[model samples]
Target chain A: MKNIDILVDNATCLRGDNLIFDNISFNLSNGEILFIMGPNGCGKTTLIRSLCGIQHLENGCIKINNVNINNPECNFLENLVYIGHNDSLSENLTTYENLEYLNKFDLSNKDEFISNPNKFLKFFDISKYKNYLVSELSQGNKKKVALSRLLFTNKKIWVLDEPLSFLDEDSKNNLIKLFLDHITNGGLIVTSTHIDFSNYFEKSKYLNMKGININE
Target chain B: MNISKIANLKYFYKHTKNVSKILSFITFSLFIVGIFWGLYIAPKDYLQGDSYRIIYVHVPAAWLSLQVYIVMAVTGFIALVWKIKIMEIISIQSASIGAYFTLIALVTGMIWGKPTWGTYWVWDARLTSELILLFLYIGIIVIYSSFTDKRQGAKIAALLAIVGLINIPIIHYSVEWWNTLHQGPTVTKFEKPSAHITMLMPLLYMLLVFNLYFVTVLIKRVRLGIFQREKNTKWMENYLND
Candidate 1:
């Protein structure tokens, strides 16, 4: 697999008077999953948004595959997929339509992907409700649809903010396995989880937000 | 070069930084000059006399009212095709401003009609279509703000705007198609204008002025909308901090 490098340098994020994180730097390469462990309200989501280039940095920059993300046209978005705290799925759309719409921007193998949105749905155990409107689905199923977006996106950098929060244990384990399989196939994953992922990832690094000063 | 490449180049150049603000300022200034020339410098008509001066305001308002809808429809197309948020913002703001001008035109037309046509209002083709144009604008804005999910709302609104575009041409050509109290074309390719150069120049100037005023106000409204929608975004934070 070719080396894929994601670097965030000297980043500072602020929400109101509270400084979420400052002077933060990190690097993730191919086949590595970096686990960001932080307490509630510690800017983990803010960090994820900044890395995705949806949120701007107060102090620094994020480089994806050696391209500066600030330009917006640097093709960085094509390489990265972000699933934020809110499930960005359209409630009025059926699960099938949601997946199809999300995959519209992707130039990947379309036939292969479309033929088996059911495959991921089955893996996530939401196959029975595959045709259900997203609004009618349970919270966990909605999250499943949001996560399913990642599978169809076929991007290298996956930035998932709290992917396991709304899932049951079995679904959580299934997701972790999916993450592991993604990393095994040479894709990079950066996830923020309050729950411990120590058992799933052998070399996962943790960032504790409790120790960081919020006022600075 | 292929049409697609030429279009892509046009799109790229259109979105090039610093273009919107410059166009906005120039259009705004022209609008101001047009308004002054139309409202004051234009010669009074021999028959209609002083009351004909209302045409300066009425014609421009009517033109921009329709023009703004066309702008919204185009921007709506862009928003849906490219998923560009800025396009949606432009669409929403343009609709609001366009609806406002359409209302102004209709009301002023009624006032002018009352004095000249012997009725303050009539269910005439041009006036009725103009009213419908106002409704379409209102419908677009209502659809945009009704939903909690902004993306979904924007998509629906864009679709609504595209569908509502049928009303624009109808409003423009209504006076010609039907024999009504509303006068026919002052300016059209197929027919010679009834207006003399002395009166027509000011009417044209007012048209220009109204367009500039729309551009200025639309820019301000769009910027405000952008700030509101992107309040939580980091770029918005940077803007606020600055």
Candidate 2:
């Protein structure tokens, strides 16, 4: 099978009576990082959701590996992971239990994460809270737990919405390093963030929501 | 297991917690009174004698059991079509209660049959169909609990319930339709009830009691199911936190 490339062509999304964004397009290849930077309410979340096939695109074609992404037969869904703005963790479960439960559905290697869960938890600085109920954790810690799920999955395309919103400075740097490591291993990382990541990714493209322009 | 932790009737109603307890208590109380009146107070049947007393509990139980299934099936349909989380929860709750009542009816019928027909069990049409209903209830509950995706499980269970409903009418009408050894409809059709007004009064009262009892248990189970499904929701957090 040929490796896939994701292309969003002339996409437009609407929220209520207002047009959130129009004619948004981009192409992402393997071993590349595309940083989506936009101010609040600029439809960065909307664009990511549309690309992940969770939201309806008013007018656009998302093509992956030369096949229409929206086509049910393409099976693009199996190759992508989209973590939304909301923390989808079940609060009743502990961090370890949550990760173990999610790992069952992951298409990636399970043994790596299963054997060294604390390594990832420490990387996110949540090692002490590993056994704590998610309901008891702070918002930033909860976001870290949610992000850990991404590390457990082996999906090629990672679509994240505001992943750095609640992380501390050190945690943010660790996440940037993790993203860089993911792309270095021939995976694609598409994330929406307001924080400046220019020092980390040299070739990352930036999109400004104010004028609706794509930057390189 | 703590009785105090089980949640009392007033507190349960206030918090909408464990509503089934109160309902079950009221229904069971009515059942006790009805049983005493039907078996001991009412005169022995002119033809079947004391054996006819079984009709009071057996017939009502059988009727309510089928009624509960229909209610469950309807809720299942709503859950599947509308994607209503509450409907799915209620459907699951009703399934267990309905199954229990169906089992009670089957057992009581067998007991009454031992002395009258000289057999505790038979492969008669009504009995067989009721057995099938019990299996359908089990199938629904099992399917719902097995899947991780609550919505998907509810949809599948709802479809199964609807399909199983086809057997309900067959269970009810098997005696009249197929000329089976089992008796035809007694309390349902008023044209010719086998018992007089004195016997019928307590039976009707017991049926009403059971109806209220089913509603009470249903409310409690629905509440528990809702708590399980909505535990992750923000609303649940607010409710619990407060």
Candidate 3:
């Protein structure tokens, strides 16, 4: 067994003059699920943003496989996938093109995924919107297009922020199934959600950002 | 430290409150002096007479049209590479402001051309390249707004701004490299400005006014934009109260 998959130590973030959250620490391993459940505006989004390396931490560090993710010598980028609270889709590009943009940036196992984008369009049941500009698609369809990036690669860590907010019931079930498949394939997921996805991942544990930790 | 970039947007707004007020005062006062000097006080062209007064406005507008694009491209490079949110806002505001000034330069040039060059329009390299520069600004704005997610919209606009930088040099050197009705570089000559002291002072004054005006507009527009984007957030509320 690996010693650790993700190690976050004393992660601190402050908003304005107030501390939104501080001294957050956690650990997770492959095939394990870490669900960050907090109330709205409780810094769930900020924490997720910090882990994805999108938001700078006021203090502390995050390491993947014992190498600091922020370190110049670390090669953790190829292994991390961050889906922010926003869909972050370029509406000018078609759904397929949006998927292709992220897929082209993969540093490893690049060639195998080129032919599979259309297959992924079908997997997310968003095939009809493949040629349509992402702006023209419905909100749920946009989320699906965003989620399709997960299908195109085998990234090790999935950092998702409020992923289930706009998803339909069937899409939610499809997402749960995909999560199970990803974990079974030795991938780790750290997600913040208002929705309870515990029924889907039985072993999933919760981390509260109110300076309290409740183990599963 | 790759993701260690910070966006002190509120900080900018806080500090620029007094600066923007001062700049607006200075730029407004200068605009009055510059227009009055160029139109009523400065000497007219020896050849074109009264028509050449447009140079005070046309030349500075055209110059800034290119300068602001450079700002956008530089900001785009930073935003894309470093993923800084403040740089993204600067790039977006720059495109709108650049496009506005590009339109001003084009219209003033055509008005100036009617008397000097015998026609109001020409398809010469410099004019066409400047037209394409307008198109590039439009493209960035259109593509940026097309995205539902404004942050991703910023990324797309940043890419377009960076790609559009190729046209800047073409617009700058078009008169020198190709035959064009537009006059050659006058105030910005590599060796020295060729204009007489009588004609040069007002153009230089307007250039300063144009640059200061750019800062004034950028500070106000970006502050308003950040407020809208960060609506209902604690930082924004605090900023508004402050």
Compare the candidates by DockQ and give the number of the best one: 3
Given the true complex, what DockQ would model 1 score? 0.04
Best by TM-score: 3
Question: What C-alpha lDDT do the candidate models reach, one value each?
Answer: 0.75, 0.77, 0.80
List, residue by residue over B4-52, the lDDT tens digit for candidate 2: 3222322343466534666677677877887788778888777667877
Q: Which residue pairs in candidate 3 have backbone atoms (N, alpha carbon, C) closer than 3 angstroms, thus clashing?
A: none
List the candidate 1 regions with Cα displacement exceeding 4 Å: A8-25, A39-64, A67-161, A166-187, A207-216, B1-51, B67-97, B115-125, B140-167, B170-193, B201-242
Q: Please list the residue runs of candidate 3 whose C-alpha ends up more than 4 Å from where it truly belongs after superposition.
A: A8-25, A30-62, A70-72, A77-204, A207-214, B1-7, B170-194, B239-242
Clash pairs, candidate 1, are B31-B209, B34-B205
CA shift at B15, candidate 3, in angstroms? 2.8
Candidate 3 C-alpha lDDT tens digits along A49-92: 88877776657788888888778887777688888867878989
Ranked by DockQ, the better of candidates 1 and 2 is 1
Tens digit of lDDT per residue, candidate 3, span B1-242?
A: 42333337767766888888888999999999999999998876667779888989888998999999999999989988876778888999899999999999999988987886678886555566677789889999999889876777887899988877975676557644654335444312223335788678888999999999998999888887777666666767775676
Order of candidate numbers by lDDT, starting with the best? 3, 2, 1
Where is model 2 chain A poorest over a 10-residue stretch in terms of lDDT?
A11-20
Scored by lDDT, the top model is 3
Model 2 lDDT per residue over A1-216, tens place: 236698888887644224678888888888777778878888889888888887666466788887887787889878888889997788899988877777777686788888888877787888899899999999999899988877778898888999998899998888888898887778888889888786787667777766777778
Candidates by TM-score, descending order: 3, 1, 2
